[model samples]
Target: DQQVKQNSPSLSVQEGRISILNCDYTNSMFDYFLWYKKYPAEGPTFLISISSIKDKNEDGRFTVFLNKSAKHLSLHIVPSQPGDSAVYFCAASVHAGGTSYGKLTFGQGTILTVHP
Candidate 1:
């Protein structure tokens, strides 16, 4: 079974609008949640992240919400622009701490299309 999943394959939003992408995971040990955005022919770039200790984290037009109890997380982008169109991937990892690099489990990417 997949540890993380994105039920919505794609979402479309008008320019200067709001876009919401949802993700779910089954691993309770995951302590860190992150979102990465990728465009065609490029590697994913880190967008934002939130720790399990916190319920939410925001940066500029991007916000990430984590519901630990529900094992779910969502990314919200406000005033979405056409340039924001890309594939968003939700990832979680159990930060083992102490210089140990734990594996990151990623959900299937959600494609977001921002039409101008």
Candidate 2:
């Protein structure tokens, strides 16, 4: 069962504040973690990622931390802006055997609203 879980359905925060999103996974074999940001109708765009071997990864205003022992991960956005209001999805994937390559398992998604 490849189930990635984002328990929170939505979050609201003020501009210039820190916004945090949480995610969990039940599949222990997932070795790669990714965070994607999406607008209303467009497909999710890759934001940041971390490997199972690393504890954290940061890219400019965004940071992602992973804890393999707990099967948990979090995304942090610093100085959130109103333009950042969108849905965020946490995805996990593992290298497939054979020629399947990598497949992603996505969570239900978390809608974040950054107010001005």
Candidate 3:
């Protein structure tokens, strides 16, 4: 079973528009959530994260909202740019273990296409 899932395989949007990516998880034990952006030939870069204790976290043009009760989370990018055209992966991890050594379970990834 997929612990985490990004239902959309890809999304397309016009430049300067908003881009929304969705994710869902089934494990209630997951306490930490993260979003990573990846470009061709490069490793994924951490975009935003939120703990189970919080509902939302934002950084500049990127914002992540978590709805714990629904087991859902989303990443919103305002004024999406061509540079943002890449794959986005949503990950989840449990922090019950000391040192936060648990591996992050990633979604299938969603490719965002920004047309200029």
Candidate 4:
């Protein structure tokens, strides 16, 4: 069963616009997180992440906020560009027993298209 899910299958936006990607998780045990972006033939790479202890994490133009009570999270990309067009995935991991396991569960992914 998929513990995380990206409800939006696709999103389109013009260049310089803000792109918002949303995700939700069913497992309360998930405490770690990541957002992976994949372009064309390249492998997925880490985009942004938020720790369970914090509600928001921002890096440059990308920001991710976690709502622990709601079991939801969202990624915000400001000034979307054509180069930003790609597949974005929401991922999460569980931290337990005083150890942080690197195992991650990923969502189905949402295709974002940024038109010039």
Give me the candidate number with maximum lDDT: 3
**How big is the positional error of residue 109 in model 1, measured in Å on the Cα after superposition?**
0.2
User: lDDT of all predictions, in order shown?
Assistant: 0.94, 0.94, 0.96, 0.94
Which residue pairs come into collision in candidate 4? none
Per-prediction backbone clash count = 0, 0, 0, 0
Provide the global lDDT of candidate 3 against the true structure: 0.96
Local lDDT at 2 for model 2: 43
Give the residue spans of candidate 4 off by over 4 A. Answer: 97-100
lDDT tens digits by residue: candidate 4, 65-93: 99999999999999898999999999999
Error of 2 at 23 (Å): 0.3
| Candidate 3 lDDT, 1-116, residue by residue in tens | 99999999999999999999999999998999999999999999999999999999999999999999999999999989999999999999997777657889999999999999
Cα lDDT for residue 96, candidate 3 = 73
The model with the greater lDDT, 2 or 3, is: 3
Q: How much does each candidate deviate from the true structure in C-alpha RMSD?
A: 1.7, 1.3, 1.5, 1.7
TM-score of candidate 3 versus the correct structure, residues matched by position: 0.95
- Candidate 3 Cα misplacement greater than 4 A, ranges: 98-100
Clashing pairs in 2: none
TM-scores for every predicted model: 0.95, 0.94, 0.95, 0.94
What ranges in model 1 sit over 4 Å off?
97-100
Candidate 1 local accuracy as lDDT?
0.94
